[model samples]
Target chain A: MSLTPSKRAYVPFVSVEHMMGLVHHIGIEQVLTDLASEIEADFRRWPLFDKTPRVASHSDVGVIELMPTSDGETYGFKYVNGHPKNTAEGLQTVTAFGLLAEVDSGYPTLLSEMTLLTALRTAATSAMAAKHLAPKGARTMAMIGNGAQSEFQCLAFKAVCGIDTVRLYDIDTSATTRCAGNLAANGLTVVECRSGQEAMEGAQIITTCTADKQYATILTDNMVGSGVHINAIGGDCPGKTELHRDILLRSSIFVEYPPQTRVEGEIQQLEHDHAVTELWKVIEGQVSGRTDDRQITLFDSVGFAIEDFSALRYIAKAVKGTPFFTELDMIADPDDPRDLFGMFQRAKS
Target chain B: MSLTPSKRAYVPFVSVEHMMGLVHHIGIEQVLTDLASEIEADFRRWPLFDKTPRVASHSDVGVIELMPTSDGETYGFKYVNGHPKNTAEGLQTVTAFGLLAEVDSGYPTLLSEMTLLTALRTAATSAMAAKHLAPKGARTMAMIGNGAQSEFQCLAFKAVCGIDTVRLYDIDTSATTRCAGNLAANGLTVVECRSGQEAMEGAQIITTCTADKQYATILTDNMVGSGVHINAIGGDCPGKTELHRDILLRSSIFVEYPPQTRVEGEIQQLEHDHAVTELWKVIEGQVSGRTDDRQITLFDSVGFAIEDFSALRYIAKAVKGTPFFTELDMIADPDDPRDLFGMFQRAKS
Candidate 1:
């Protein structure tokens, strides 16, 4: 209607720099704590949200996926790609961006770089699940596969689940050193371990987040003890898993969404009919979590659209009155809605 | 590892203003002509594309959809929303944006405003189909339902299909007047007709593109005569159709991706097993188009992803060395690919 775009035509876009600024504005530990609460709140009302398994296009080298969800009022989707070989080319193995729109008008409200947001959400989700499923009074976590996601997981655990120490291990020792260095000022006692077994020593929460496109065991059945929680993050696509099948057999498996988790999570190693609990049910208090001290609980985390929805929702609220986003003239708005051609013609002059 | 992001982290973003600048720079008619050729080229090599029905999330008022496709070398996807009621609230009925990326590294290379692009592509597709199917010596087009897309369609037919006259008609005379006014300087005979019957007089090509989210027959069986090519545009999505079922039964229906058209195009009114020719085959010469002057050829046009892909491909090339796009730091690139956490941590300093 106006010569310049109306307010509705502009979508708030948080770029990589803006996302980094937002993370620092809200401290990383605080963001993790807030994101966990947001995720938990959404999980409690999971039935109201439209959930679908991410649509993925797989290539020989990697896969690109679209994860979408709507809670009736707001709709959200994330465009993410996972290329395991990308790291070798000096590129991120996983890079993502997302959009949030008003469900009523179907107008986008926010577009954001989700690479950093994803790292925070994934860690927050693992921490939130551990909070409900891990052994009581757990103060130490074994973070195996110390790659890009290692420090975030360590900080999230400290903020959300009260873990005071993180024992880190990676096949590449330099990765472990880098992760340890990143967490040095974060107030957590970081232990650089030589092997996965060494990392697990006295740690009640063990997280497996290795980056490989094959069935590789980061954790074996013999290494997992009773009264512990296994936060499995790397076993995310079919043919890519971290824990041995025997370890899964020994633990009670919990997943984000069964239909998707069965295909992409660590539980892919088990039968389709294998008994597993949906984590939302536990978070909603409809099912028991860690009922006894000696029980082995495993949150087979492949991530889900709802968690991203929660992250977007959280960022949308957090960016209000903040210099963390720029307005993008993404939507075309003609003064008369039926006069787009006229608008184009006028633009020529 | 470098402290600043590399060239790979920046994605070129074409905003609405930039898109308009591009269209005017290229000349709307030239852009339409180029788009038609691009779409035709993609159609000729359609088998090389990974095609699938767009994933849509429909609400009571409108729908949000993601259309994704990949040629082994490159990947593209569009995020579009259609809200018919939005116009009443001073919003465009449809708004869109799309992205293109390298299939190898799974990194986004371009992000562009596709609302204007979609309009151009849709018109180009219609004109492209008409060029292959319209009867010989067709110089006049009956452009029914003069709305946002009317002028674009008329110009495209002129540029690509050699139609010199567009007879426009709409239920709202203001729309017809506006459309005719916009095309006055475009060097075509703009006939603002009073009724649908008046618009079709001596017209060899009839395009019905009305925007109502219901089955309203803008063209009935009795109204459409023989030897005319019907470009049905508004019969997109389920519960929407612009032509009568009787008309579909009488015409030789040609569609882009039968799997999708059968559910969303004018052919949706016909039986699922009803015979229809895939348009790609016709373009590739495997199937004949307009065998005789008396034969009715219907291009059951529901926009497809490959057309959008072709549009993105065209813009990706067209925007080269042009000031029509801005680079957005949409992706996170750590110099050391495995040090994303360190990158985030350093941003604090």
Candidate 2:
């Protein structure tokens, strides 16, 4: 027997392989550039969104979180887990998936593997922030703590901010080597460095994305120059930070959302009432980004739900005419909604 | 190019059809009985589980909720939506899907359609509660508001509490006809009634499972007898209830997870600190169920996440050696955990 799923029964699902295929088909650099544009568009209309801090459940090993947001028309949420020790057991430290649904019906429209999309969106957001805060003609980036996200960050900078060189460093030299090898055939020149200080030498932009779960100083106040933009991604959860406190004291800090950043970003080390600039204000031209070339600036990003929402929307639109998604029969739609029992009885026959 | 998903990438997915097939294969009544046993076992070990009020996002039309819970070893969550007006437009008023994950790694193990499973578990849970709370030798159940959930409630009572007769009533006569027609082949004798009062005549157990989203009462205080057990299922959200407050005043109310039931269950109409017994305590033998034939008992159930967790675990275990599930390549697993960039790059070839 064969069954034809009704329109409501099928939801478009982009698996990991199909997500990779879509990324490659769209050209990774082009996709990153497009994502940055999409994110910027949403950020410009930030006040229209319904935002909330992620709902998290933490255990001794790691934390699982659900981040949800809506723009009145569509709803989206990402289910992600962070387990730093998972890599030691041959597992990814983070895995994620997301769904987009219609606000009118509350039915899921698309379900996609978001591990790859997250990497892309995080990079795009960092580059988008740097585009407004970085020094003019910034061409080189110092990528500290080379890990799974390093290459995507490097390429996003090259695509969005015109960065042509990336100097990489990690405590584990093998990670730096892996990152360099992955970027070998990509357009940018990759520089390997023995220390964070060496990697920071003569770079106009600095990115730190280490995976340690505790407070660790990847950059001291002395290592950071005054004229560069800093992208901080690793110090995301409570008690986790990358840059030394002294550096934050000197830089003009900007954050995605203050309530969430106060708990999960580098600002957690500071007082609750400490003044910080909202990133959307700069994007909206309500505040100045970099008044002088010698002034330091930092983007304290703890990934937000809006970015994931934008990425899901981007993928849902990108895969429309492409064969990169499969329709999964996920919803139970009966011919007569009140006859759900009859639907099951007929299915038995 | 062909891609073979590794074990880490594959998450077991049970679609709606597959879930129906699994239910039929296991026999509907037997599945209900097994689900009740599983739920009871979990209730016995209740203190070992982490519980929280469901995270809900409400809109003008409906509400979408994420209900999450975790034992020390496994984590589970259900994504469910409720839109009362959906049935008028030929859509199920409630649709759901759920995920179960490994707590240590925070990776999803199973993804299953929970619409059918939810009906099964909700009925199973109701019957489980009735088994302890209902009067001895209670063989008749008056089912008010015969809609999607009516048949399941009837069958579950038959299998779990030895209920042999069901008297059905609905505001829509067609709904009552549909429900009674569906139950015609089942082992129980079905009686059609024109009004709720007619259905309640000579019934030992009264079940109200209406779907209206208002403060309307289907049963009045004078309509209920002193010795009957009332299974109230439809007053599951704020401003939606089936029983008048006077009936609640005379009964010993049992609830699941007081923190949640206080807001969404029938008890929302009561005071903040209104005394109610936790159903787990009754199952643990700490509290009395039906102390005497003259005492009134009420199972005021607003579904909890632990029940969904148990249902997911049961499905994950039941379809072990069966063809009732499909593997979904949902997680992106790099060969080397830190080389996620390399994995994406290699997938391009």
Candidate 3:
């Protein structure tokens, strides 16, 4: 018997190599811009989504979480891990993959490596939030953590928020050097700074994405200034925070999902009932993002499932008729649905 | 500039074809027997496992679920869907896949097609329960539903419980014919019955595996006699049941997980706090299974994540150095963990 799989048996898989090729093929800047647009569009329809806090399995070393969401037609989920100690052992601190399935049949349509796509989407989401909340005519961004995510954040800001310069700082100077070297040829003017305060000087947008498992303040209250947008990316899990509580007190905070952000974001340090604005509300015009120039706006982003869903949707669209993905025979398609045993028996020959 | 993946970058994937080959390579009867042993061992250490009720997304037509469990050393999850109406549309009513990851680093170790493996494990689990709870010298099993799972159940019982005869009955006589034809070459003596009553004649074990999304009475109260172990497999989802309530009221109920079985198993028809014995307790010697010969025992099998975890562990061990599985380049392992952007840039060549 010929083993040609039917359409339902195959799922398109975008590997790490293909995902990188896709980013380069579409031009990383364009991918980020398009992802930002898609995320913004999804946020506009937030009410239609089935949202829940990610299902997490915590271990002594790190956490692995499954973030799932559906918009009535498509269902998406991301399996992500965060082990801060992995980097010291020559492994990624965060690696991820995701799937998009048809809700009608509950069959997966796409399975893609989300490690690279996650960086792209995180940068896009941060830049998109900055575009809505940053000071008018923002031209410079201070990236405090010069880590794996630094270069993507710089480029995303350059593409989506129109920033042309980035000031980089990290306690480990080699990280700042690496970040500056990557951005040197990417059409952005890069400045390596001696300290976080130096990086924050004259910057209209500050992005803190430090990697730490504890509640160490990467940015003190004195470092942040008025009229700037602060993008807090790290401090995603419990006991991890980057910004000072005083800084959070002064800023008008925005979050992806309140139930999740309250548990995993910088706001986890504050009272449970701390007031904050939902980003979707701002995108939907139900709430204002930045009403005054001098008001400090903070996007406390603990990544949500819907953003991953949006990124999966974007990849599913971008890979159509392209050679960036291969079909994986993932589902079992017996010729007779009730004769799976017979299918197994026949395969013996 | 070589693109060869590092050691940690690859995850082993067993496709449906590879899974079928693996089963044949190991001998199907041996696989089922070994799976039963593995599941029984896991059940003995059930308190060490981290368990949660499966997260399910229900629709009008079917339901999809994510079942996850961890034993501190390893973590596993299965993505499964059930749509009873699918067979009429030329699709399998159920399909599944699963992953096992390292708990320390949260890296996936294996990805396998679990639709075939799920059938194997479910049969193994049912037979394992029957071995402990069935009447001594049980030779004949009345399998009321002749569908996809019927053959595996028949084989598992023969291999694990020493059953030599299987009497089959189905609402559709063609189903019964197909089932009997498949088992004709096997060692068991197959008998086709015109009604449920004929199938139960002289049978020490009664297995109801019908498929429907309604309150089905495949075995009425008058049909089920005393001292027969009823393996209830098809009443796995809410509003979908096989045996009548009268049958449940008289039988001593056993379940995998009380929280899940209460909501998805035949026990769902009972009260919220209905008394039921956990199967693991029996395996651990903390509770008795069959204390007398004339008492009816029912195994309310709703399927649990730990069973999938055990099956995954068995596959991960069985496929070692074998050609039955292939390696997949799933994880992105950049030489410098902090230089993900640089990795993408270097991959451009």
Candidate 4:
């Protein structure tokens, strides 16, 4: 018997190196623009996908989550972890990887390192939401929390929403300086501010992407003005909200999946029975987005599985015939599928 | 800056070829025996694990499941899929991979192909349960379905429980012939039987591991004699079972995790409130295993997450300092955790 693995036994793997190469080859801004459109398209047909709240295993120091979804023809899931303390040890606060499989054979088609992909997708998702909810003619964004995700968010908004300027702030000035330096050559006018209040000046959009696992308020009610869209992406776990209660009550809230947002999003700060529109409904034109120019629209942005699914789907296509992936013998396929032991015995030779 | 991945950025990956090499180097019987011991040790301290039913995505053609568990220090999860139609397409009916991460940092430390490891662990878990539940001096086991898992089950029982003989039978004579051939020189007295009743004639233990996604009786109630230990492993999904309902009623049933078993095991044929002993409880001495020699005992084995976790822990140790794994740059680690965008820019050269 031939010992070479069959095509069925190989899965295409995109490592961090390959992902970076793919991103740069496709151009980050172009990739982000395409990802936003792909996410918007998936959101348009959201009801066709199977949606469930992520399965999370929370520890005292961190949390690990598995977010899975399928669109009838394909299945996808992402394994991600959030450990705020990891940065102190020179590691990322979040790391991730994901898989895509064919629903027909239950075989994996793609496995990719999702740390970089997640960064791209999360920013694309934020920019996509803002495109629908942010006030028309909005060209400036207040980016509070100039940490790892700041530059990506700034660039995605520039690419997807036509925002040309970003006002950046963080509790640590070093992070703000780092963010400002990264955007210097990206064509975005970046202003580094000392405080959260200073970051909001002359900005039509507010994006909060802090990393504290607490209830500290990054945006008080008085700081958020009317007619600006708020993308609260940091308050993703219970007891870690970013917006104040008053700001939540005043805003017209929208969320990805209500069952998950009620537990993990900024809406968790609101009453359990508070009204929130599903983002897909608005994207599909079944519900209105930004009904009035002066309306306070809050996209309570806790990440969802479908967004990762969209990213997986996009990467699976984008890497085709490109030198952005290598094959791994991750699956075992015997000539006679039922004789797995015979295959094992033959390998003993 | 060095382009080489830092230690934290690398995760050890065990592929199919490496897994086979490791198994052959360590000997399959030794690996099975070691896996059984590891499973037992974990079952002895089962309460420390954070357990949940597998998150399953069911499609018309198949099911994909994520099984996750943590023991405070480490977290592990397995991604497995079952598509019976896959065999017809010259693919394995089941395929799997797993990950292990440190709970403190939530960083994935290991990624291993589990399609083969899963078969090993399942048999090990079965043999471990039979060691506690099987009658004293049980020398012969009737392996009713000679599929991919049959040889592993036979060898595991031989190594862990000292069963010197296995009676094999399958509806397909070729399968039975193949199974007998595989076990020929394995130090077991292999008997080829024409029927399930003939296989059970002189056996005190019976293991059923068929692969049909339906409710079909491979063993009738009248065929099962008193005082025999039954390992029912084939009835793993909803609407799939092997034994007659009357046989399940006559046996003193034990299960891995009741919540999962009630939905996916032979006990699904029974009432939702049926009393069944947990195998871990028996291993922990919190409950009894087999009360008398004349009382039928059934291990209704629907696999659980902790078993996979135990196997992961085992492989993580076994592959250390060995040529069984390769490091993949799966995690993106920047020099400064907050300077991820800077890392991207630096990689451009």
lDDT per residue (tens digit) for residues A1-349 in model 3: 5566578999899999999998899999999999999999999999999998999999989998999999989889999999999999999999888999888788889998998889999999999999999999999999999999999999999999999989999999999998998888899989999999999998999999998988999999988888989999998998999999999999999999999999999999999999999999999999999999889999999999999999999999999999999988888888788988998888888
- lDDT per model vs. reference: 0.93, 0.93, 0.93, 0.93
Per-candidate TM-score against the hidden true structure: 0.99, 0.98, 0.99, 0.99
Clashes within 3 Å, all models in order: 2, 0, 0, 0
Residue B309 C-alpha lDDT in model 4: 96
* Residue pairs in collision within model 3: none
- Model 3 segments more than 4 A misplaced: none
Candidate 4 residue-wise lDDT, B134-214, digit = tens: 999999999999988999999999999999999999999999999999889899999999999999998999999998989
Candidate 4 chain A weakest lDDT stretch, 10 residues: A337-346
The residue-by-residue lDDT of candidate 3 on B149-225, one tens digit each, is: 99999999999999999999999999999999999998999999999999999999999998899998888899988
lDDT of 2 by residue, A1-349 (tens): 2355589899999999999999999999999999999999999999999898998888888989889999988989999999999999989999999998887777889999999899999999999999999999999999999988999999999999999999999999999999999999998999999999999998999999999889999999989888889999999998889989999999999999999999999989898998899999999999999999898999999999999999999999999999999999899988888877888888888
For candidate 4, give the DockQ.
0.86
Question: In the order shown, what is each candidate's alpha-carbon RMSD?
Answer: 0.9, 1.4, 1.0, 0.9
Per-residue lDDT for B191-265 in model 1, tens only?
999999899999999999998999898987888899999999999999999998988888888999999999999
Interface RMSD of each: 0.7, 0.7, 0.8, 0.7
Lowest-sum lDDT 10-residue window in model 2 chain A: A1-10
True contacts kept of 1: 0.84
> Every prediction's TM-score for the first chain?
0.99, 0.99, 0.99, 0.99
